[model samples]
Target: MGKITGFMEFRRLSEQSSPVVERLKNYQEFMPRLNDQEASIQGSRCMDCGIPFCTTGCPVNNIIPDWNDLIYRNQWKSALDVLHSTNNFPEFTGRICPAPCEAACTLNINDDAVGIKSIEHAIIDKGWEEGWVKPQPARTKTGKRVAIVGSGPAGLACAQQLARIGHDVVVFEKNDRIGGLLRYGIPDFKLEKSHIDRRIDQMRAEGVEFLVGQDIGLHVPPQKLQDEFDAVVLAGGAEQPRDLPVPGRNLDGVHFAMDFLPQQNRVVAGDVLSEQIKATGKHVVVIGGGDTGSDCVGTSNRQGAISVTQFEVMSRPPEQENKSMVWPYWPMKLRTSSSHEEGCQRDWAVATKELIGKNGKVEKLRAVRVEWKDGKMHEIAGSEFEIKADLVLLAMGFVSPVQKILDAFSIEKDGRGNARAATDGAGYYQTSVGKIFAAGDMRRGQSLVVWAIREGRQAARAVDEYLMGSSSLPL
Candidate 1:
């Protein structure tokens, strides 16, 4: 659609990452952006196929082909408009999203995807540089107030949408900062806090008030919000981290990944840590070979760890996916993150049996290689071994949202312990309580930031319609 023969003319060009040695020195963004011309060439590779499976592949249902075509034609402003129409924060998704959209791109079936993610990143970055990104205050005031709990991506997106619709919105966060997980869980190297800061500034300019250090269900009663605001939206993240309940789980050097990651992030933000968990000079063993574990590896390397090792219970994924069979859908395959590129030993099909330590501190990890047969994991005989470890970070992921917080609201929960809410049909996202609503991880459980944004925007529409009997906001 862009160049007619663009797909045949141009090949995919991805953003370049900084050299591993240089990037590992400090916690900063290392991905180098593409020049405008280079980005255009990549964008032009989009075929704009009739099916356009990339749209469905993206969690936010971004208008991928339209923007790709616009970018290829050097219509920067129009491309930005198309991008902003669907995703409130293309910048965030462009940087950290897994980009399943590219995986599902028709071009990917035969060759590389059109470098869609990089093109998107370039477009948003350009928009910001050109001062084209600005606050969009509602033209008319609705005079209705809404309270949003948790200022993570979900709450922030919901508040932004509600504010854009002329509703008075206030986001309450328990932490001292506006961003929940984004400000804490993610490292500064991956996503600098300034990105979040500027967006918060924009939201504030749009009439969305943020209240940091305000815990809705804790210090401030949930009933208070319901009474003060016309409607209340719950967007608290699922933060109950899954832990390894092994013999030495209670040891001093062992900790949850959430507990460990936030401290490092805070320290990077120039906050003085009283008791920072440092991997300095220690042999670090990170359990769970997910993104979080990879993050730990990077952080530990930065901390000058003697050695870093990551463990995964599941069998290793294939080096390459059978594209013919899994095209247009996310396929399981081995993924090595930038952090992994720096340094670390990754082991799969290995389960930690117990933590061994002396003097009440974690010292070693005892594990065994496992073999799967008939849907069961069997430990191999004589496969047990011990790895030296002074620190252990459990990054197995989250179990559910903090139950006590939800319990404070007396909200009904789904079988998964998330807030019971529907996303389809009219009256969607309404909690058991008449005036209450739910979205994001609190409603759908732990998920990607893109999914949270989608849920938040949709829930905003639901709440808006419920309040005024009509809504012009897009779901």
Candidate 2:
């Protein structure tokens, strides 16, 4: 408590974003980080609660209070260190995380929570501007090689930790780039690929080798890794998209969200496309109103879609949650993303009946309004309607990691199709295959990047202990 009554004296300040019309003009980051004075005030709003529920709420378990105080005092270098102590990459989480940490803050009981995310964002931005962020190479060599299959957050975090602790780490990415979802899945407007590229440069300096365009099972045999490397970490994330099988599912205009989103990302990366799917002059309809669906809406608008509409199977959530019931935990509530604000027609509690197409190309969709009773959905009588849609994007979510790679190693899978592995007690992160480990979405299913980083760091610790009978790596 640097200023004893700072929480009572200061009000929370949110990050500022550019006007919708201006930002929609191009694919670039629009939110400007909080200035120094504004960040210090936001940091002062921290209650410094006895329990500090914000840390419990954050998946990475950041030491929030310590960093807040450091930022309030304008000691940014120290604040950045405290922020990075737990989280390997604050920049990614600062930009994309939903910030459950704020919802669980002590001040959020009756007042606005401290701006922890924006403060973190400011700290990291300053760290980079001042050239404070750098790589830490191992002091001694372990002479043991570890192979990580995936360039997503989980694999990257795990490899970084192992590399710092004297293990020879090699990251194999199936795509032409190093970042898995960060490079392709997410839109550049939210997180530009340069952040990932810079981190890759740092990792390279720390002695981690990256081999792109190598599909483990298809391009390289799994046995070769088992025979050559001392250990392997399977961090291949959940890549299977959920399908909407309707009467006109095979229509030429229908595609998965991943298929559409990645194509646009490639174009932004200066790649010329021949078979690219475009929303130009088309009426776009995005199914399943999650982050993926919202992303589709933004991309379609930028691609010059005539109109964009989003549909959700579930009923609309409450504008505000009942904090009494869900305090200190993530609650269900209506979330309107910046993309939605750009321009979108949102409808909830709707069910897709079938796709109505012409000449094998989707032109419209048939749907009905539904009501939920006792957790079961029932279509309303005479509530059928048709919506014009030339492009239909399935953005419901992912199911599991690619099964072929797992099967190649003969790894046991859970009921959810994710690799079966324990999180604690002996055999932690170890798969059915000897000397093989699984982490992140490969073991846990689809999740947030913060959780992926957590799993990766913990998995690295487990692997280190397994190799040397102990580890200094933080959990």
Candidate 3:
């Protein structure tokens, strides 16, 4: 509303990225945040729509229009405050979150949606640069100890909220580092680790303790946390990756995307592995067409792979969606990520038949073209083909959380193997086990990082109310 006709005057402007040839040489963030003027212009494009669908579209329900107006009015610090009021880590969401908010924007019905993500990216980056982001340690202690399992976005968000509310919070991570997936699963090219590191520092200053290499169910028994802490929150993500059960799946060259992705991230963090999976000089085939698969393609191209190919079982989506039919909602359409633009041979509606290999090492992949009818798949006759593939990465989405952790605590599980917990009513986020709660992927299955943050924040409020008999924390 800062400029009434600004939406009509300005067009959407996306952030620029480094050239493909130049960026392929290293694992670093390619896209730079919009400059102050560009961000302000982008913010001004926010139309004064009667109802802001962008907020409802976002999992965290970010105050979009307010911040956009603030940015347009040159109130950078206030914009940062509005952003942090809802999102615990806008930096993470700003960098990696697929912005559903943009798809649901009022302007997206006919014209390009406002560049909300870029404006958010600029706001948070500027907040850090200007020292507007700092520790907000609680003034009074509640004397209640909370144990948070998993140090990803969910656990971290929960810990920060509880800590800032005067509760003693301790985050336990199985990995040797603080960030769980953020430190390992994602490539540095998409989101550098320094952002996570700085946030960790701020959390530490806020009185949240982080204990790395501490496996809760394994090294530290589940009973210890329940006995020691007043409350326990399980924010561990879904780690059980879906597998292709075709013959030769156990071949040496075939690996889960998690296995391959984390190693590269660790290497980028200066850890030298004794035996690491590399795509160097090999024909790489990444199965699955989601973000994980795109990550594999980018990493493979950077690792000097002879060739990189990506396969999606589903048919290719249209390049553009029919806005009239799908307006104010996320639409199914083609999305080419920065990794895809780097270099990748992409094919859709192809299903892998089997892995063809020599000497227990995968050498090629045999697949078939298939057609879908009435929600059923039918293989096309004589459409089988084989392609050279020295490395095959299974990038299909994760199916469930590791069952062992749930079993260790005797927690009830849903039909999908996620911890059984409700989001509303009494016993919200509470597991069957007393004093135990579940949030994020552990409760809702694998989802976006923004959803994880939303779950974490809400779970914190639930726990707060359970402890103090009342909570002022935002839901």
Candidate 4:
């Protein structure tokens, strides 16, 4: 520890965001970073605990204490090296990750935890500015070729790791550009596409070939991929959105969150929209109070919506957590995102009953208050109400990976419909079909980017060991 009393002397400090008014005008990242001296002070707040729960909390299992010490000592380059050793894309995680690590920090029991994510953000941004981050291609060739379907964080990490180990890695993406959800599903306000573009350039230089517009099970045949590559990795994400089947389910104004968010991202990227779903001059109601729903709220306000209301079926979470009960694990607490702050009317314990419309288009939403009892939800009596709404967005999370793709491969699926595969024992990540493996959302269901990257890297190691008798790649 640079200063043993740092945690007591200094409270946690993180990135400052752009003014809400200015940031809401454009779809650009707004988080301002701390200076080097400030970052070092935050790093020194790390307790250097005997058993670091932060590492365990992090999905990628980053060496938290080591990097914290490195940064506290002002060894910025070494901190980046240690960070990259485990995570292939710290920038993405630093920006978007929820930082379960902070919740699991030992200091969080009664005090503020170390600002690990902010420090990580500062370190990686500095690394890029200094040109310390560069592509390192393998020195020799393994001659084993691998094809990875989907170019999200998982597929990208897997391809990068395999390419670094002298293996031929090719990524197939169904979209016009790579980064799957990162490129499109996320708004440029949350994560700029430029970050994804720079990383794609680095991966290309390292010998990872990317083929866009290749939709397996639709445009690209599964058999063709099998025939072309020695092995295949299905990292395709869960794209099926969980739908709300209600009285006005087929209404003209109803749409999925993915369909709405991607359009704004495209417009921000300079793509012209002939005619689009505009919330301008209309009352917007968004269902499902998760991140996707929040994104929809932010987008609607930017589109000049008359007003925005977000509904959540579940009861409101506690503002503060019981640290003694949830220490070293994620807690149930209210999380208000930056988008929520821009301007939103949030309602919890509310359920949508129907959509009232005019001339086949939605005009209002009928909803009722809900109460949970005995693990089952009950609608409260006389609580029905109608609210003005011209646009309705279903922001409920995804249910599973597209069933068509799973059926095409003839791979068995778990109860949740995700590809049935384990991460341990013989043939880890291997599918029922020989020589085929699955990772990320395909195998584990929809999850965080960090978890997806971790699974992809581990699956790459598994595939490498399966191909060559032995392997040295880190999982």
Candidate 5:
């Protein structure tokens, strides 16, 4: 427990961000970390309930209250230890995770929830500043070789755990860089690339070999990995972005969110793009109003777009949740991200009908206001309209992992096209092929970064158990 009555005394304090005008000028993280005293006070607000719903709500099952108590006592290093005990990358989750743990807090029933994510950000930042983060090389080697495809959070987490257990781990990434999505998929403003780079260095120091530009089942065949390594873990993400199959969809200025976002990320990382999709001075229309769509809005604003607009197919959610009914769970409420705060007109229950273009380029978009009734959505009478649009970025999430690689390995896929693998029991994560296993988006489809980390850790434990008769790694 932190302070006995602190929950009643303190209110939640979120991380502060720069003003819209200033932050939109460049693609950089604007949220400032809390000071030690402020973080301690926030931590003290923890009620330390008997059953921590935050732990269950969090995908990785973080030990929330203990770390909060540790921070309240000014035990920064101890707080870091407790955080690292469960989460392999608290730093990543600290920045990008949506913090479902906060929604599930008992205090959120009647009062503001404890600033768990803010405290985590402060703890991990302090750990790095104090040089507490370092490579933990295994004392002995188990001599089992593992081949991991993909360098995203899941693969990275799995590799780190296996390396600590003395496995000969080698990760293969298609991109020139180590981090798959973290390095490319996510925009740099939300998450800087240096974080991934430093972690890659730490893993390298821990004896994990990373081979970039080595795409498994492409440049190198899956059969080679089967022959060379004791086991293989597929952690590649679902890259097949859902397309908007409308008229003039093939026109110039129409692009995928992943395509546009990654180009800017590469540019931020000092790579000059050959076919960069820029929103500079263009009237940008973003499709799909999730994190990816929000990201497009942010990026377009940064790139000096004339105007930005977002569209969501679903009906608008309530500004605030009815906490009486949805307390201790993620509720259906309106979420306005920092990107949204910058400036953009947002519309709900509007569906894009067609991309109206001329001269082989998009010039406008045709859409219609829709009504939802009896579980079906239909267009409202005479609600069809058109809007000026120079660019359209589809952020409608991913459908499945790239089928080319899956087919190359002859891996069996579920109905949803994700790799078919169970998440429980003695031989979980094992694919149809005996030596091969799958985890993260490749197995479970698109999900939060925290869920990917959890799957990676669990898959690592499963792999460890499979390799050595049993595993002592945490579930």
Candidate 6:
């Protein structure tokens, strides 16, 4: 620890966010990174705990205490190195990850946890500003070639790792641009696209080729990749959104969160759609209380929606968790995102019964209050209600990956329809079909970006071993 008593002396310092009034007018990142001194102070708050539970808590197992000590000692470059050693994209996680590491912090048992995410954001931003982050191209080239499907975090991570180890890597994206969900699913207000753009540039410099609008199963034959490349990695994320199949679901204004979100992202990226879904001057109802739903609320407000309301089928969580019982583990609790803070009417334990509409356009939503009893949900008597809703966005999360890609590869699938692959032991990450590997959401179902990166890195190592009969890359 840099300072033994630092945790007792310092309080957590959070990043500053732009005013809601000023930020709603545009789609741009509002949270500003902490200055050096502020970041150092936050870093110093890391306690001298015997074991850093934060590392185990993180999906990528980042060396939190080491970086915290480095930041406190004014070693910014070293901190960035340590950060990058584990996380391929700290900027993405620093901005959007829920920071379960902080929840598992020893100090958080009774006191505020260290602002690890803020410190990470500062380190990475500083690294870029000082030209510390640069291309790490392999000195020698291997004859082997690898094909990666999907340009999201997992695919990008896998490609970068394989390329750095001297293998020829080509990433194929179905969309016109790289970054699967990051490019279109997320709003710019939370994460700017420039971060992904810069990484793409770095990857290209590292000899990773990217081909857009190349759907492996649809446009391009899946057999071509298998024939050309030594191995194929499936990193495509789960895109099968869960649907609300109630009455009037076929209404025109009702759409999946993916359907509505990507259109706004494309528009922001200067793509003109023939017909775009907008929340302007309309009563918006976003179903499902998750990050996607919160994003809808933010996007709706930005589009000048008359009102924005969010619903959750489950009961509301406690404002605070019992740390004594759930220490060193992620706890279920109420989490209000920045979007929720901006403006939103949030309700829980409410289920939609039907969508009332006119002329094939959704007009209102009929729902009812329900309660959980004996592990089953029971509708409350006389609690039915109707609310004005011109647009309904279903953000209930994804169920599995698109089955067509799996079918094209003739790969075995798990019971949940995801590509069947293991994460440990021999032939790990290898699909039942030889020479094919699956990682991230394609293998593990829908998950966070950090988990995807972890799987991607590990999958890269697995592929390296398979190709060379051994590998030195980190697992």
> Per-residue lDDT of 1-475 in model 4, one digit per residue for the tens?
7778889888899799998899878888999668899999899999957889999999899998888888889999999999999999999999999999899889998998889899889989999999999999999999999999999999999999999999999999998889999988888888899999999999999999999999888888999888988889999888899999899888899999999998888888888999788899999999999988988988898888889999999999999998999898999989999989988999999999999898999999999999999989999999999999899999989999998888998999999999999999999999999889999999999899989999999999999999997789886
The ten-residue window of minimal lDDT in model 4 covers 24-33
What's the best-to-worst order under lDDT? 3, 6, 2, 5, 4, 1
Model 4 alpha-carbon miss at residue 246, Å: 0.4
Which 10 consecutive positions of candidate 6 have the poorest summed lDDT? 1-10
lDDT of 2 by residue, 1-475 (tens): 6766888898788888999889888999999799999998888888757999999999989999999998889999999999989998899999988898998998888888899999999999889999999988999999999999999999999999999999999999999999999889899999999989999999999999999999998899999999989999999889999999878888989999999999999999999999899998999999999999999999998888999999999999999999889998888999999999999999999989999898999999999999999999999999999999999999999999999999999999999999999998897999998899999999999999999999999999988988888999998
Tell me the lDDT of model 3 at 34: 94
Query: Where is model 5 more than 4 Å wrong at Cα?
Result: none
Tens digits of per-residue lDDT for model 1, 1-475: 8587888887777788999889878999999678899988888888958999999999889999999988888999999999999899888888888898999999999888878889889999999999999999999999999999999888999999999999999999999998999899888888888999999999989999989899776679888988899999999999999988788889989999888889989988889977899999999999999988988999999988999999999999999999999998999999999999999999999999999999999899999999999989999999999999999999998889999877888889999899999998767999998889999999999999899999999999999999999999886
Q: Is candidate 5 or candidate 6 better by lDDT?
A: 6
lDDT of 4: 0.91
Query: What's the residue-level lDDT of 58 in candidate 2?
Result: 92
Encode model 6's per-residue lDDT on 70-104: one tens digit a residue: 99999999999999999999999999888989999
Clashes of each: 0, 0, 0, 0, 0, 0
lDDT of 3: 0.95
lDDT of 6 at 91: 92
In model 2, state the lDDT of residue 407: 94
For each candidate, the alpha-carbon lDDT, in order, equals: 0.91, 0.93, 0.95, 0.91, 0.92, 0.95
